[model samples]
Structures are given as structure tokens and as C-alpha cells.
Target chain A: MTPELPTPRVTVDADVLERNLQAMATRAAARGLALRPHAKTHKCLEIARRQVELGAAGLTVATIGEAEVFAGGGLDDLFLAYPIWPSPQRAARLRALAGRVALRVGVDSVASAEALGRAVPGLEVLVEVDSGHHRSGVQPRSAGEVAVAADRAGLRVRGVFTFPGHAYGPGRQRPAATEEAAALTEAADAVTAAGLDAGVRSGGSTPTATFTGVAAAPGAQGAPTSPGTPTSPGALTEMRPGVYVFGDAQQLELGTCDWTEVALTVASTVVSRSGPKVILDAGSKVLGADHQSWTTGFGRLLDHPDARITALSEHHATVLFPDGAPVPSLGEVLRVVPNHVCATVNLADELLVLSEGTQVDRWPVAARGANT
Target chain B: MTPELPTPRVTVDADVLERNLQAMATRAAARGLALRPHAKTHKCLEIARRQVELGAAGLTVATIGEAEVFAGGGLDDLFLAYPIWPSPQRAARLRALAGRVALRVGVDSVASAEALGRAVPGLEVLVEVDSGHHRSGVQPRSAGEVAVAADRAGLRVRGVFTFPGHAYGPGRQRPAATEEAAALTEAADAVTAAGLDAGVRSGGSTPTATFTGVAAAPGAQGAPTSPGTPTSPGALTEMRPGVYVFGDAQQLELGTCDWTEVALTVASTVVSRSGPKVILDAGSKVLGADHQSWTTGFGRLLDHPDARITALSEHHATVLFPDGAPVPSLGEVLRVVPNHVCATVNLADELLVLSEGTQVDRWPVAARGANT
Candidate 1:
């Protein structure tokens, strides 16, 4: 009895969401790791407040705008986990944000560290290291130099962090988790040798979060080279997994979460049907256009496992059903899990809350377009 | 100067935008086609008003929410150019919208046509016929049956439309345009034979818009068959091009537009610089992640043409410059054109207006995230 809401609407099941939040929080606590869940995935203040109530250390945001939103919602501990080159305008906003919360930012280069230090002096900073994902981060060996630069620029070097993004690839989750741990450990050591308090070595992505710090977990093949000595300042100290809160088609395909664990889904209607293709109203605008090369399709139908969304237009999803599988009739509502939950959530202004198959509340995606 | 705003800001060059609007309007006027520009690209009320002022016949939208926004913003006519499956909730909204605006919707099936007729009897409906892109719509020969169903269900069959989406492929613009004309003509003939008023044979996409209705124009390679006899109900009477307002990397690479024609770009700041990779703050979040396999990369830099965005995270665009190309320093602002303009504009809250290289105003994307 999924509520008959508008098509292409995002719906979050409250019952499953509580489980997801508690499960991740419990997992991180058992490993003695700080749970600073990435709020960029679910920009809802309700979700952030719940995460905090579940014992999360803080929240990790991708932009100063997001940090401001969450900080204004009364979250005290906020971290901007991006190599921010704050202009005077963003610097002023960051200064305002820092005044109300325990704000921390990421620094990957000396120039950015200096600019940030000049913008907001005495801000806590984390040296971003490349954990085999060479997008935007310094090498683990060069962390000491960047930390030294931040220290000289009047910023406190807290520790280091790396995103194990490569874990999303096939069969690379454990190896990426191991590389992330090793990179964070090396970077933390570098910062410590530079006479800075490198107490936080953070690393995690949804694919590798389950085995990030705890080597011998409940269902792990092997450990990631013994994730640093426990309790050491250089150990894996924090996890910032974003997509775990709302398991998506990617996480399900990667075996990170089962179908039962998904909390958020797009409710769409079968708008048109051809020979073997069923078009859903939910397309890239609602389900997101994140079709990973390794993924099976654009997304998956939660109830109809055999249905695959083969292509997407602005507002049309071309779903292909297997030979004898039943394709939904026109106007029939169906549940579709997005390929990437974060991209999907960012597309909608609000998410419909559901509990026990009944409509409950509506949570506004307050930071839906907080891109600046 | 580009305003000292935050990184990853979307900017609309007002001068270039006006030129683009006029260029398309003029082209349509010369071709005798109704210039119903697709408003989904910009979603700004100011741009829509300017388009109306430039003699546009009306606006085309992808969703009811978008139609509602434009209609509320003083647009009197709109067409939802998709096979929409309106449930009761959406039917109510559409009913309300049609009460004020000259609203029309697309229908490819008798079921949807009858449903729309029941929801709003006497409403004008367009039979969507497949030209070449088989994502949605019915075969051209089958348009009459759906039109007949709408006629019997208390709805007016106003015309037929086909989206020449295959024109986006490498050298298929002319072929797709030909296919669109031939298909629309056949569908309109079918509807006319069924005693229906098939006056509007609409078709166009950005890549194929210029060659859609006109036989020979400024840059015509050749003519696509002899278009239906002028003044006939089966003639191509309208063009619906969305991306012309904001020329993107896709349009530039397709040769539909030059770099100077680009009106919108993401103003990003260089946050980190690796050996050959320069990371900008504009990522998939700001610049929508619509990377077609045929495209060169995720996006392109407007000023530094040699630099290609190799990869993108949520908040980092990994740009690679060829050897001998001068890379911008950290904190240096640069303009990166998105691959798809429609998706890019949907991601931002407001567009920074620039006229003659100076800041003007901020236009909110009135229909952004209006995914109902």
C-alpha cells in the first residue's frame, strides 16, 4: 500500500531509515571510529538531526552552503570535506558558519591552505591524501609539507582523510579499503612527525565502509593490512560514508546492501509501453542519470527485480523487462531505486516520508540547490 | 568582471542569451514555423519572458510542474511534450493549469489519451509519433487511432509531434530531420483522414532544430525530401529546441554552435592542482553529469580550450591540460561549459546574470526541482 502520491516523487521509508542510521552508527561505534556521515546524500535536516541523535560525531559536508544549512539547523560539529579555495565571499560565509559551529575544512594544496588560513584564521584543517583515487588530493608522503604550510598560515592541522572512491569498481572494495587505511596512516604519520596533532585519520566510501576500520568484521573475506594499531593517533579514526543511509541500485549491485535495506525509492508511474519497453515517468530528473559502466542499467525496479531501466530522457525512463516478465500497465505506480542515491536526492525539493506503507510526513530537501 | 561569487556558480550572459533568443526566433519566423522554445533549458521566468517578448509562440515543458510554473509566471500557452501519466493528484494539478493556460499534452496511446480526456474533457491533445528515436511515442501510422480515441473521449486532437532525438548522433542531423518530417507528415495525414484537426505537426531538437522546418537556409547542406506542401495540415509547423538558449559542450562539438555562441557556463575556482590535473570546484553537482560516450570529456573549459575535464566528483572537476598549456593557479576562477545545458540549469538555484562582462542580476530557476 505505497501511498498514491505524485509520480516521480522521492519517498523515504521511516522504519527502514531508522534501521540504516542505527546500523551504521553501531558499526562505527564498535570499531571505535567516529561516524561523521556525509550529509550531502540526504540534505534533509531531519535526517541530520537523527544521525546526531544516533551518536554520530559530526557531519561531513561537500560545500560551505551545506555546512551553513546544517549548522543553522543546530548541528554544532560540521566538517567541509573538500579542497575549498574560499574567495572573500565564501570566506565571509565560512567565518559566519565557524562562529556558530565547530567548523573544519579540507586542504589538499599549500595555496588553498594559505588562502583559507587568510580567510578564516585558526580554523581546523585536514590534509586530504590520495588513496589511489587521484582526483584532488596530495600524496601521502607530501602531507607533512601541506600540513606545515597550513600551520604556518595560522590553521591547525587536525589529521588526514582520503576517499576510497575506487571501491565502487568491481571486486576492488577490500583493496581500496586497505589502500585508504594505508594512505591515511602514512599521511597521519607525516603530520605527526611535523609536530602537529594528527589525531583524525578519516576514510570511507559506501562500498568499503563496512570493513573500513574493523578488519575482521561480521562478513568480510579478509582484513585490510590491519587498519593501523588501534587507539594510535594514526589509526583509522573516522568514516564518512554517504550512500549508506539510503541504499541505492549501485550499492545493491555492489552487494553493499540488500533490497530489503533500501530506505529511499522513487515512486513513478508507467506512462507508456511499447513492444518490450515500459516507460516510467521517473527519468534522470528524478532517478538521476548516474549509469556506471559496471551497473546493470540506469536503475532497478524495487518490486520487479527483473525489470531494468535501459535508457532515460529528461522525464522518461525506458525500462526493459525480461521475456516473460510482467510490465506494469499505464498509470500504475512502481518503486524505482536510483542508481546513485545522492544524485537522486539532490534532484527533488522534498522527500515523502512513509511508515508501514502509509504516508507520514514530508521532509524538505532544504539544501537541494545549495550548490554555491 | 565575473562577480566574486562562490565557486561552482552558474552564470547567464544576458547579452548572449538575448542574441540566442533572437536568433532562434528569427530563424523560426523565416521558416514559417511556430517558435515554441523549450523552457526546460533555463527554467528562469526572466528568460521565458524574454523569449515571449522575442515573438516565441509559446513555451514547451517536460512536466506539469514546469508548465504550472511558466503559466503562473504569465505564460498563457504551454505544451507538456512528454507522454505524461497523470494520476489523480497530477490530474488535479493539470486541470487547474488548463483552466488558466492554453495547456496541451502529448499522448502516444489510446489509454493515456482517454485518461487525459476523462481528467479534462475538451482538452487539446497532440498524438506523439515516433520519428527515429524510439525512446517513446507510437509508430507514425498509428497516430490516427490514438487521435480517434481522444476525439471519442471528449478531447480535441489538435495535431501530431515527433522529437528528432537521433539527430544528436555524429552525422545524423539531416537524416533525422528528414525522418521527423516524413513521420510527422504521415501521422498528420492519418489524423486528418480520421476527421481530426491535425494542424500542428511539431518536431525539433537542438541539433536538428535549424534544419527541421526550413528546406534551405544559411547553413543547409541539402534539403530533406520535399517537405509536406506548405499550408497543409501535414506540414512541419513548429520547432521545440531547448538547448539553443545555453549552448553547451555537446552543441559546440556537434558544430551547431561556436564557442562564442555559448551563453551559460559554470564559474569555478581552482581548488587544487596536481602535476597535469587541475581540480575545479565545479563538478557534477553544479554541471550535470550527462557525459555522452561520444563527447570528449565530462565538460570543457571556455577560456582554456586545451583543458579537458577528465573526471568529476560531486564537488571536484579534474581538468587535464595538454602540454604547453598554461594551467590556472589555485583560487583562479575559470569558466567550464557543461555537457548538457538542460540538466546543468536544473541543478542550480539561481543564475548570475552578466551583461557586457559586468554583473547585472540573479535570476532564480523558477521551475528547478519541480519534479512532480
Candidate 2:
């Protein structure tokens, strides 16, 4: 029998997690791409270990604090996937981390590359290119400038990386993956043309990870990336998709995965039922307040698909059930899938592992507050 | 000498914080209302101690986990202001907390009242009334039924509480405060008519707290609650506002506080400057992704008020400066004021207290992950 846990807790279905891990690992392996699952999604050392056990090359993090947490936990190979500004405090931490692990950081500007090089000379760095996100990365053609700056500053320029963040919207995965590959190829040429070896070409998001290489199938090993495109692989050497292991409402609504594949959910109890509105104890504090424009609500009820979270307070999620449907009784436990899994995981300190409706284990979110 | 801190760090201006605390305390004292600052805003025991030293009645929390953390830190008077569904696990914790401190809980349903009464008989419970937010609290007229049930179950039904959440928007504070007063008066009458002592009529929000009584001035004290209405005080006995201490974008937009009064900000470094767009190290992970419709952007730059954070990834904030204006130089330090102070504080594990640009002290967010 599984031990009863508290409400408003993040729970991971053990079977679903295993299947997701194996599926992503197998797909990346079949395409001959290194799988470096982004630890920013789960922030759990146990899940990172599972990913490594499934043949992941390394782990990707967004902050130096995350890298430190994962590295301190004995996971050596790490890549910080953001253009980190090497302040004096972070520089010392990065130098310490680089001394201990195979560390590679992302750089998008000459200023940042020089600062990082000054902070830790001979540090391995990757030039970040903008596929379409237009958030942080430089242009594909401009990658050479940053790489040359890093090389001139005695920092080893390893490769180019791009985040196809625009692929997050509905029905944008296939084209975004194609765009990512083309951008990586262009950036790699730029880096190599500047007398720097672009050893790695890294790019992938959760939505586009399923179509990373041209031959990746929906659920199999071989299929065309698009309807008319042939299986001509490009320069992306690795895939870094974080949210695949724990499918969220965004992925579910985007049709990236089925509801059964949603491994993570917030277990909440119905605290108040007023007419058609049922309030759950789980709110933004537990599920995270990441409401995308395309998201129908803050989150969706796992058991009752028709129930939509109309509003969220700090500690109360007001869900409105469809008319004439049987409302959930007060104190009835319900599972809620949040809009974004990474933000939700960041809000939690640990994840409750559930096996067949029973508590199997607990996984601490090791880097939960590693926001530096 | 000021020690270098990491970028995207939560820093509090000591002078601004002291002013905010003293102003709120003075206002509450002048109005003869108990000021129980919501601990969910800061979560730092040092800040809570400052509020208590300034004559706060106690503290208000959102969860039992927070209550437990505060109780362990030697804060005796605490209130959990949400309709908590007492599970066996939480029930045990609440029982322990009740035994250690003066505990008060919010109740809105018969089932929760009965369960709470059984779990900890004779515990103090306040009936939650929905003023206007339409979120968790019960209807103004239905407080008697729940109060009667609590009485029958041997629980002490003391007074009522309403969160004037509608006052959060622009130009709605005074009207919403009036609405809150009417609702609290109606609910208090119901509870008193049910043979329960309605000793506490608590109603508040950050925006409406300044207008709690009808005599609050537009920018001072002694103004009517609404247009053409006389300055007649209603049934609200006390006020609970969390965000007045650390003003946010929403508060600034609503004219509740000026930019100079904003006490907290995230210290970020400008890592990338691409034409008109500037990228900062602070993103949603540190500042929180709580964007209200009325806010200008994800956050605003404290130094350069014209700059707007147009986009936010997990680890980067893309700020857009006004065209023709001198942009921030690369590696320049900037302070970002987030949209929601409560959510922002919840995301941080600690706050750096700065006085005259010098790091004076550090305060741990003692209940950062107390979300159970």
C-alpha cells in the first residue's frame, strides 16, 4: 500500500517517468545526437541520475547555481545554456565549478566572452546563435565575432548553440526544428570560417525535440521531419529538451504528448465547492503562475478534462466545471497539470514519486532556488 | 566595504523598507486597527520582526507550512488566512502549531469547519467572506450557516475576514474598500446573529489598506471612502496587507505607491546590448512570472525607468530602451522592480539588505518553500 501524502504536492508517476526517459533517450540515440537533458526542468538529482543512466551525455542548466548543485551531486559534465554575465561573485563560483567538472558556458557577445575569459582563462565556451527566439542569442552570421573574441582571450570556443524558444507555441515544432538546424549549420560555418573548430552544434526544445533530426518519427525511429522534406540531417550534434520527462499543459495542448504521458501533476484537495466553482488548495504557489497566451487556463484538471482553472490566488485555484457535470465533493483529491513544468518544479522543494497511486519515494528538487 | 553580490539577486533598500514599515504601522495605529502583515510577502523572519516591533498585531500566512516555520522561529501569534482543508497530515501539524502558538485559521465551509473542529477542538476560526475577488471566501450572507456549524462542532467562530482583492487594479482602491466594508459589516452581522462573537472584522489588501476606514485621505488621512459618501466607519476591525512594504509594478501602476517607496528590487547585470534591446540576468525565475493586465511589463528598470522588460526567458530578461536614448553599457548594474512583490519574494530564498549601496545584512526567506 502507498502512504498517503499531503495535498498540493508535486507527484511524479514512476511508470510514466520511466517511459518518457526511455523514449527520449532512444530517440536521441537513434539519431546519433547527444542527449543532454536540461536539469532546469526537474531540478531533481534523482531524475538527473536517471537521465544519465539512460545514456544522456551531460546535463544542461540555466544558472551557475544549478551547475554547482548538479556538479556537487557528482554529475560532472554540465553546460550552462544561458549567456551568463560573469560578475566577480559568479566568476569565482564558475572558476571553482570549471576546476571540478567538464563545464561549458554560453556566450553571445564579445563583452561577455572577454569578461568570462578574464574571470576564468581557458574556459570552454559556446557561441549562442539566434534561431528565431530573438531573446538573447546573436545572429547566426555573428557567431564568429563572439567565438573569435573568446579565442583571442585564451578561452576555448567549443561550438555554437541555439534555443528554438519560438517553438513553444502550438503547431510550431516542425518548422522551428528545421529553422534551428539551419541556424546551427550557418553558425557552425561562421565559427569554423573564423579559424575556430565548431566541435558541437546544440539545439532542441521540448516541442521540437521529437523532430530534432529530419528522420525522427512521432513515436518511432524513422520519419520525415515535415510532410515534403527528406531525411537530410543538418549540423545539430546534440538535443537539449528539458520538459519532455514531465509533460505539462502546454505540451498537452500543443499535442506534443498525450495525457497519459504527463508524468508530473500537483495533487490537490477540493477545499470549497460553491455551485459550479470548485476551489482547490493548489494555486500559483504550488503549480506556478506561468500563464502563456495560448494556455486555456492556469492549469487543467487531470481527472476532469472539462474542468478549467478560471482563476488563481496565492493559495487557491478556482476551477469552474461544466454545467450539469457532477462537481467534485469537498476534500476530494484531484491532480492538476500546470501550464509550464519548469516553473512549477522551481516552485517546489521536492517531488513525491507515486507508483500505482502509492507513495514510492521522494526526490528533492536539489536546485530549486539556484537562481543566481 | 560593500561585498560584490551575484547578479539577479533580491536586494532590499533598508531606508525604503523602514519608511514603508513605519508608515503602515502609523496608519494602522491612527485608525485603531490591528496590522497583521502577511508573512507570505517577505517570508523573512527579520522583516517580520521589524513589523512586530512596529506594533503589528501578529502575522498572517497562507499555509500551515508557513505557520510552522514562523512558530518554530518563536512568532507566537499567527493566522493561516486561507480556507485550509485539514488532511490527517496537516491536521497533526496544525494541532502541534496550535499547541505552540496563538493560532487562527480561515474557514468557509461546513465540512472544513467540522473537520477542523474535530482535528483541533476549540481552535479559533475566522469565517472568510468574499468581498469582490470571487476567489476563495464565502458569500457575505452565508457566514451564519458556516458559523453555526463551527459552533455546533465545538470550534470558536471569531469574527470574519475578507480580502479586498479587487482593489488591486487601477483607480479601484477606494470603491473596493467601501465594498469590503459593506461586505464585512454584512458578514459580521450574520455571525453575530448566529450567537457567535464577531470580535474580529478583518478586511484588507495592499492597495485598499490605505483606504480601510472612510476617513483615509487621497494622499493622507481623513478622506471619504467613495464619492459623495460620508466618512462613516464600517465593521472592519483590522487590516491585513502584504505588498505595502515592498511595492511592485502593479502597486506603482495603481498609484498605491511611488517609485521611490518601492523597497525591493532584483540587482541584475546587463550582459547583452543588441541595438535597442538590452538583456539582463534577472528573469522570471528570480522576479517571478506574475504579470497582471494593468502592469506595463514583466518588470521595470529602477535606474532607467524608460526601459521595459518586453520578454523573459527562464534566465534572461530582454529590456527595450527608448530609441535615441543612451542604452546601458555592457556589464552595467540595473535594478528590476517586478510586477508582483509577493510572488517575487516567494521565488527568492534570501534578501540582501542594502544601505547606501552597501550590503548591510542578509535575511533568509525562512518559509520560501513552505507550500505543503
Candidate 3:
């Protein structure tokens, strides 16, 4: 359902969002994993508060800037999930944030750990291991080396973590999660061998959240087999799924979520029509230009499933309808599901919180443009 | 040159920006076309003021929200260059804006024209015609029908305009420019045949700005070729070119601009390294994800020419260096040129305006996220 608000508006169905959150929380509880949902997706404090109320152990953030936002909003526990190369100024901010909250940062190398130790000593750090996503993190075999360096530098080496980012591709979630479990096990063992806690083995993307627990259970791996409880000193204890709160086209296409569970969509109006081509005002600037190599189009029409967004400009999305399919008239509103909801939310000023197909509140994306 | 500011910060080289702006103004003036540079590129009030000082005829914006932002910033002339599908609320806003400034809106359909006519009397309208970009606008031959309908609805039919967006691809600039001229001429004739002014035949994109003038001059078509003078009531009188203010990787790869003139770049820090892959803090959230099919990669490193952005996540850009090339060390700052500068600017709250090598000022991207 579309709202009567401005076109290209980012709208969140609170009803659907509630279901999605509850479903994810329930799934994580059943899988014996502590859920620390990523704050980068919604960037709204209202959602973060709801997530906290739903029994989320804490929140996961990507940057010191994001951590500052959440911590300022009274989020007591935060995880900066990145190989954060903090500058002097940022380290000062990190020290300030650590004083206010239960803070933990990701460290992938000895240099990074040493820098953090020098700047923000006594800070807790999770050694990042490369779990098939070569974008960041060190090799699993070198986890202890980094952990020892972190501990020696006066930083508290907590545990090891990995991001199964390769699971984002179609039909790759199973393999990626399997690799994640194996790698996290090896890295955690190395950290334990280094005489550190190695407790918080954090890993999970939206696509691999389900498989993360399934692959890491007692019989599944070294992880425990309990539901609703995670006891870990050397296993995958936490899962961070950002887009699960607002299901997007990527998740829907990847079978990570269903259309009925999608809580977010861009409410756009048809601005131009040329025969079978319907132009929507919601484009890259609003819905985001995130076309994964495997996606059907730039985005998808939530209402008209058969229509494909053939092209996208800064202010226009050219949608094509199948022959004999009804075309949306000019000024007709359409809901567009973004290929990547996180990218879409980052471009918005606020998200219209809707309940029962009516706008009930306006949640400011307070952390928007906090890209320090 | 990079600035010592926050990582993932959008920085504008004032010196390079000045050169680029002056060059485009000179080129437009020499081609005898009114330069109404699209404000969607920079979105900074300071830059819009600079364009006005440089004798820009006016500013072109994509949405009424953007128009309101510029107008509120003391700009009086604005063209909402889209098939504006105004709701009752937006129509009132448009009426208010039309009363305050010299405003013109694009209308490509009879229904939209009638809506505008009913809601905003005497609003000047430009009928949009398709010029090979099948995304929006009507067929050039049917421009008269839309114009006549607009006239019958009591809206002022100003002229016809088209966007040769096909020029964005490689080796298509010439053909796109030629087609733009022919389409504008035919559409202008059709508008004239419908007893309208047909004065503002506006057309131009970053890639086709130069060719637009070259292909439409008197000997080339119906346009006159007097440098720094545009006499128009029937030809391609105005060219609205965005992205010329900030040279991007797309413009660089398309040979539309030289690397030396690139003004805006994201100042990022190398945060993680895995063998040959170095990850930067600036990812799609900072630089924007606008990868044209013909481009080399997501973006380019301004200083390290051999490095390419291999993959982009919300908070990380995986960069790869050529064999034997030095990889950026942890915390080492780098400048990344975005693939689409407009998309990048919209993601930031402010632009670090730099002169020489230091940040002289910070200009707010006032119209950022104004995508309504």
C-alpha cells in the first residue's frame, strides 16, 4: 500500500516491520544465537529502540560515527563491526564512546590492534578472520597472531568474527555459511590457543542468518545446540542481520525473505508514460542505484510483479510492462522495492512509519550523512 | 591532492571546480546557448550562486523540492525539468513557487498538463519529447498533440525539450547529439504548428554538452553559431548540463573531461588489507554505486591510477592494485572519484570546499535528499 505523502518517499510499514522483527528474533532465539542487529540499515533510533525491546543483546554498527549516533541515543552496548582504521581524532571519539557504552571494535591486523592499543587502550577487540569474503579480515590461520598482538598491546582480545559476504550471491548462502562456521571455529580455536577469551564469535548477514545457526550447531559445528540461549567462549555467539528488519528486493530475490514480509518500499508516482514504458519518479537518488549482477532489474514493482525496471536515471525509473499487461497511468502511485534497502535508507532524510496503510509517525534518519 | 579531514568525506577542490565551471560557461556561451546548468550535480547554494554570477540564464532542477531549496537560497529562475505529476499539495507548492520566481515545469502528457492548468493557471510548460532515450517523454512527432492539449488546458506552452541520455554510453555522444537536435527541431516545429512560443529547446547532458552545440549550429541544423550569443525562439536555445561541475569517473572514462579538471572526490582511509585487496572506508554509501555497463569498475582512485574499486559494500570498498604497485597502508588517506558525481553529492550532508590543499570552507548540500 502506498501513502499520500510525497513521491519517492521511503516508507516503512510498521505492521510488517513488527512481524519481520518478531520473526527474526524468534528465528535467532530458536537457533541459540544472540541477535545484535546492524544499525546501518534503518539508521533510525525508533527502529533501534524497537530492536532493543525485542531482546536484541546489543546493536552492531559499521563506523565510529554510527556508534556515536547510537550511543548518543542511549544504546548502551554497541559493536563497531569493521577493520576501523581510526585517526587520532576518531580514536579520541572512540575512547569517549567506550567510556559511555559497552564498546567493541573489529581488528584485522597487528598494526590496527597496536594503533588502537596506543590510542584507546583497554578497548575490547574481536579479531576479524577472512571467511571467504576477501574484502577484509586476515586469514583464519593468522587469527591467533593478531589476537596475541592485540593482547600484548594492552587491548582486550575478546574473540574472532567473520562476515560471510559471499552469501549475497544467488544460491551461495549455504556454501558461504558453511565456510563461515569452519573459519570461525578455526579462528576461535587459534584465539583460545593464544590464551584469550575468544567468546564472541560474531557472524551473520541477512542472507546467511538462517544458515549461520544451522551450520554452527553442536552437531552442525562447535556451536551449542540450545535455543533462545547462546553460551560461548569459543563459538559463534552473535548474529548481525541488518536488512532483515526491512526486507528488500535483494532479500526477496535471494529467498532470504518473502514479499509479504517486506516492510520497506519507495512510494513513487508515475511521472511519464511512453507506450509500454512507465517512468517512476523514484530512481537511483531515492531507491538507490544498486543493481547486483544477478538481479532482474534495478528494482522491482511490488504491486506489479511483471513490470521490470529496465533503466534508472537520477530521477526516473523506466519500467516496462509485458504485452497485454495493464500499464500504470500517469500520477498513479507504485511501490518500488530497492535492490539494496541499506543503500536506499542512506539516501533518505526520514522514513514514514505506517500502520495499517496510514502514516502514523515520521522517524528521522538521524544517522544519515554521518559518514565520517 | 587529499585533505586531512574525516575519512569518507566528500571534498570539492575549489580551484578545480572554478576552472570546470568557467570552462562549461565559456563553452555554452561560445556555442550561442543559454547555460542553465542543472543544480542536481553539486546541490550547494554557494555553487549555484557562483553559476548565477557567471551569467547562467537560470538553474534547472529535477524536482520541486530542489527548486524550492534553490529558490529559498535567493535563486529566482528555476526550471523543474521533469514530467511533474503534481498532487494537490505539490500543486499548491508549485503555485506558490511560480508566484515567487520565474518558474517553468516540464509536461509530457495531456493529463499532467490539465492537472497543472487546473491547479496552477498560466504556468509555463515545456513538452518533453523522446530523443532516443526511451526512459521518458513522448515521441517527437506527437509533440504537437501534447502541446495543443496543454494550450487547450490554458497552460502556457513554452517549447519542447529532450534529454539525450544515450550519450552517457561510449561512442554514442555524436549520434545522441545529432538525434537530440533533430528531435528538438521537429518537436519545436510541432509546438509552433500548435501556435505556441517554442522558444526554450533545452537539451544537454555532461557527455553531450559540447556536441549538442556542434551538432545543432546553423550549418549543422536550425541553430545559430554566434559565440557567447544565443538567439532563440525556434532552435536549441538552452543546454542544461549537470555533472560538468564535478568531473567523475564516468566522465573521465567517456573522455568527456580530463582528470586534471576533476573537482570532487571522496577522501577515504585504507582500513583493511588482504593480500592484494585493500579496503577503504569509503564505499557505495559515500561514493555512490552508479556503475555504467561500459565503465572499468565502480570508481577510480584519483592518485593511484592503477587501482580499481573491485567491490562496494555499505561501509567498505574493496580496491585492487596492479601487480608491483604499492598498496595504501592502513590509515593512509586516498581520494576516490565517484562513477556518478551527482549520486555521490546527494549522499552527503556537506561538501568540504577546498582551496589549494586545505579545507577553506564547508558548504552544505542544502538540496541533498530533496528527492520529492
Which segments of model 1 are wrong by more than 4 Å?
A1-4, A215-234, B1-3, B215-234
Model 1's CAPRI class is medium
- Tell me how far candidate 1 lies from the true structure as C-alpha RMSD in angstroms: 3.0
State the RMSD for candidate 2.
3.2
Clashes of 1: 0
Instruction: State each model's CA lDDT, in order.
Output: 0.86, 0.88, 0.88
User: How accurately is candidate 2 docked according to DockQ?
Assistant: 0.69
What are the per-residue Cα lDDT tens digits for candidate 1 across B1-372?
554767788988998988888999999888788889899899999989988899998999999989989998999999999887768887888889989999899999999988988988888889999998998899989999999999998988899998988888788887787788878888988999999988999999889976777533322433343544332222589999999998999998888888989999998988899877899888777787887888899889999888899888788889999987787898898999999988888888889998887889999999998777
Residues A151-201 of candidate 1: C-alpha lDDT, one tens digit per residue? 999998899988889898888887788778778878888999999878888
Instruction: Name the lDDT value of residue A99 in candidate 1.
Output: 89
Least well predicted 10-residue stretch by lDDT in candidate 3 chain A: A226-235
**B236-327: candidate 3 lDDT, tens digit per residue:** 88999999999999999999988898999998999988667889999889888999889989999999878889888888998999988877
TM-score of each: 0.95, 0.95, 0.95
DockQ of 1: 0.73
Weakest 10 consecutive residues, lDDT, candidate 1 chain B? B225-234
**Which tens-of-lDDT digit does each residue in A108-143 have in candidate 3?**
999999998999999999999989988788888899
**TM-score of every candidate's chain A:** 0.95, 0.95, 0.95
